[model samples]
Target: MTVQFTPDRLAHRDDPEVSKITAISLSGTNTERVMHIVVDLLDELGPQTPAELEHVYRSRAAVNDWPVVAFYSVHKRVSQMKKHIGIVAGTGVREGGAERVQLTTDPLKAHGKITAHMQGGDE
Candidate 1:
């Protein structure tokens, strides 16, 4: 379960999806943490709407006793993840329906990225 990190062990190296995720250099304080949380949640839940993402974020924030994770924050992160990471894709919806975003890679591939990240490797 404990995957050791090395030059070759980076999630992006072996997986194309992860490669896209890691290709972009994240800037600003705490961006990395936000990206990690978004990736982890997507890996677990597959595709989701912005509202669903907000719900997940709120639940996590509550569990950690952290400040509320605002809906805007979740939306921003999701958008960034789609633009920079490339592992997530969005589907447009009708006027009343919410747009949905999901991982571009298959479940097994996502599992690889998730496992690598969970084990302290980079994605």
Candidate 2:
């Protein structure tokens, strides 16, 4: 099924990958850091479920020379960024208490900027 996203639902978002990706991409000096993580995650699972993304974060953190705060904060920031840009898709809970999330349609297009805050080249 096609997942739909709306402003209200994004208000108290829980998924971190989306927000972290968006924030880092928007960060003038942190795009490389953000993109590197995102590219790795994307490559590993194509797109990911929220739980899977969390696992990816922990694994990457272990392998990379990044601190825990840096890893988690980036995840949270990317999630917020995703909400701001209206690119977040799916709700946090499914019928069986499972969380669901994935990159939005046209991720490459929607992913250009975390929000409309700036309109420039893609990260």
Which candidate achieves the best TM-score against the true structure?
Answer: 1
What is the TM-score (0 to 1) of candidate 2? 0.46
Give the per-residue lDDT of model 2 (tens digit) for 1-123: 222333223324454555534443344334334433553465456655545665667677767864443434444434554555445455565533544554554545544544232333344
Number of clashes found in candidate 1: 0
Clashes (candidate 2): 10
Q: How badly does each model clash, as a count of residue pairs?
A: 0, 10
* Model 2: residues with Cα > 4 Å off, grouped in runs: 1-28, 39-47, 62-75, 91-98, 115-123
In terms of lDDT, the best-performing candidate is 1
Poorest stretch of ten by lDDT in candidate 1: 23-32
Quote the positional error of residue 111 for candidate 2 in Å.
Answer: 3.8
- The C-alpha local distance difference test score for the whole of candidate 1 amounts to 0.57
C-alpha lDDT of all candidate models, in order: 0.57, 0.47
